[model samples]
Every structure is written in C-alpha cells, then in structure tokens.
Target: MTIAIRMPPDVQSVQIGEQAVVFIDDFLTEPTEMVEAACQSQFSPCPGYEQGKGYPGLRATAPSEYSLRLVELLEPLIKINFQVPEQLDLNKSACEFSLTTVAPDRLGVMQRTPHFDSSSPYHMAVLLYLCGPEHGGTGFYRHKATGFQRITSENLQTYSDVYSDELHRAPPKPRYFDDSDDHFQFLGMMPARFNRLVVYPGSLLHSACINPGIGVCADPRRGRLTVNTFFDS
Candidate 1:
C-alpha cells in the first residue's frame, strides 16, 4: 500500500514566546524515501519509563542521505536567522534522527506520562509527524512556577496562531499542587497532520498523546510516526 505524504509550503520560522516550545511546518525535503528508510531500519528500542517518571524515547543515528536532506531543508531557516545554530563548525556532523511511534487510542498511557529529552545536549528537538487528524496529535505544555497545565499547540499545529488558555491565568495556589516545584503547562495541541513538523528547545518540557479513537494491531502498526532530530547547538 502506498501512503500519501504531503509536504507543506516552505516555512519561515516557528516561534511563540518564552514558553519554551516552537514549531516549523513543512520542515522536510523532497525525496522522503531516505527518511522513510531510516525510520524503518532497526534500532534499539527504548524500554519506556517507570510508573512515576517521564515518557521514554528511542534514538537513531540518522543516515547521511537523510541528514544531508535535513541540512538542506534547514538551511533556509538558518539563513534567515529564524533558527540559531549552537555550533560554529558547519562542517561538523551536527544532526541525528530518531523515531517515536505512539499507538492509537491509548490515552491512559500518554496523559499520565509527561517528559523532557534527557539526552546529553542537543540544540533543538525536532518532532516531524507523519499522521493526520484521523490519528494522534502533539500537545505542548510549559513548566509553571507551581503546576503544569495544558497549553496551545499554535505555532506547531499550523491550524491557528492561537496560544494556550492556561498560561495567561494567575498562578494557582494550594502549594503542593503537583509532583515537582515546577510543572509543564500546556501551550498548544497539534491535531495530527501528515508531514507536520514541530521544532522546539530541547530543554523544554513536553509530552505526547495517543489519538484516543483508533486502535493499533501490533508492533510497527502505529497510529502516529514521530520522527525526532537532535542537532548541535
């Protein structure tokens, strides 16, 4: 079966504010075959997190073909200074890709687990999704002074420029509201759209959610395919 993948028009930039999350729509190049091949290739499976921690993410060493394509795609964003690179050496290998698959309709598993990438150091965290509204959506949240609430997926979703509702409200009390002194509040929710890409600061706190309507059959038959890339700052 041939899956239809559509790439949006070239994006300028995807930035919101100090909230810590940003997005870049249509962030891939033509020749998506390389990326597809790399994503389908075997790599180490992330075991996932425990009962009281964050979500688990798998990492893959992106193939050169895929990496080169990514660099070309990102050059525009970099040239306009829409995105700042953490490295001065353009010749250095500064990109790595990973794929995170979220099964459909598994809300219970997703909502409960919130997380941030713990990998050593990556300038930006790129989340390029290959699923449409019929499946999962990417939600953005932020770390509040107290607890974390849901935020809007504005710059990420490509639907609207609206932001999260919770951020504007006054900080709530009750002191012991959440697990940590700081919690990630929701910013925007990206309704699953094929070939949509969300790029944000690697230090930001974020998480993923299942579609809640569809169901998966088994491994490799995922409802959403989230391709991740960590680039040198």
Candidate 2:
C-alpha cells in the first residue's frame, strides 16, 4: 500500500514561557493502516529507564523508508522553527514506533512526574500521534518553586535541590502527574489527535497523560501509538 503523506502550508506554533511548541495537523495523509501493520509486525520490550526506574513502553525499529522520509520532512521545519544552523547534523537522530506499557501504579517516583528528554537546549523531540483522542495527550509543566519550565545545565542544580526536597517532604502518589502538584504546575496541554505532530525542546518539563481506562492496551494498534523522534543539532 502506498502511504499518503501531507504537509500543511504553514505549521502552527505555540509559545509557553520559554518553550516553543510546533504543531502540524493531518501530518500523515492516511498512514494508519500501513503504520499499524508495521508496528504490530515486530516489537521489543522498551529498555528500562536510564535511572533504572521502570519501563515506560515498547518500541520497534521503524522502517528505513519511513525514517528517511520523516527526517526529510522535519529537518527544514526544525531549522526554521528552532533556528538551528542551515547545515544540520543528524548523527543522533532516531525514529521509532512507541507504545505505552507500564501502568500508573507501577510507575516509580521519578516516572510519576514530568521529565525532560535531555538538558541540552539544542536537543529537541518530535512526537506524532498515531492513535485517536481516547489515548491521552502530552502536557507541559512548570516547576512551581523555581518557576522553571525547562531544566538546563545552569539550573539543573537548583531544580535538583528543589525536587529532592519536595520528594522528601511529600512523595508523589502512584499516578501520572495531573494538575499542579506540589512541585510542578500544568502550564499547558496538547490534546492527542490522529495524524497530529508536536515538536518541542527536549529540555522542557513534559509528560504523557496516560488515560488509565483507554490507553493501556498492550496491542500497538489499540494502544497509544506514537512515532517518537529525537534530534540533536
């Protein structure tokens, strides 16, 4: 089957605090059938968190054709929207099909909270929603104490100190970060829409709003299927 890919005339962007989130609707013309087949065909259990907390989900190596096409479509946007150099270095670029697996109760203290994919401002994440709205969306947060939305090298120590202190004072319960917790405030939310893509800095504090009732399917087609990519300039 030939996959249909569509690009909007102009991508929409939203700025929250210091973070700029780019959104593109109807990103894939009609990719559900093809992508779902690919995801269900082969998948491996996602690796444990780097800090050895808990596994978030499962991932499958995406097809090279799809990966190459995605990079081609996103590179120019990244350059223009994020203001990266014209000459892009994609040595660290990766494309994969991801599915959420671990339940909220199983999440570790760290997993229960929002997190940054990386602390480098140069790094960015692109997430394409493959499922419908029943699957939860993504959220951006602000660390209430420091008023910091994106953690960086300069503020990492301060963020860490505050985070540690908060954890000690009142530990997070066994659930995904919802509204304003003691430490983080919900700055904004991006609802999950089929064929929608969201791009934001990797340093931003964000989390996937897992719909406990709907999104926990182990089956990729029925679960919260998202194409997650990371790029470093």
Which candidate's TM-score is highest? 2
Assess candidate 1 and give its TM-score to the true structure: 0.56
lDDT per residue (tens digit) for residues 53-169 in model 1: 233334455555555666655544442443454444233243333334333222223334344453223345666665556655655555554232322232233211122333234
For residue 47, give model 1's deviation from the true position in Å.
5.7
Cα lDDT of model 2 by residue, 1-233, tens digit: 44545855348999876778998888877767656555556766676743436448777766566677677777778888988888767444657788877777777788888888888867889888988888878889999999889889999999999898988888799887757787888988888988888998889999998897778766877888888889886
The estimated TM-scores of all candidates read 0.56, 0.91
Q: Please give the distance, in angstroms, between residue 46's alpha carbon in candidate 2 and its true position after superposition.
A: 2.0
Among all windows of ten consecutive residues in candidate 2, which has the lowest summed lDDT?
46-55
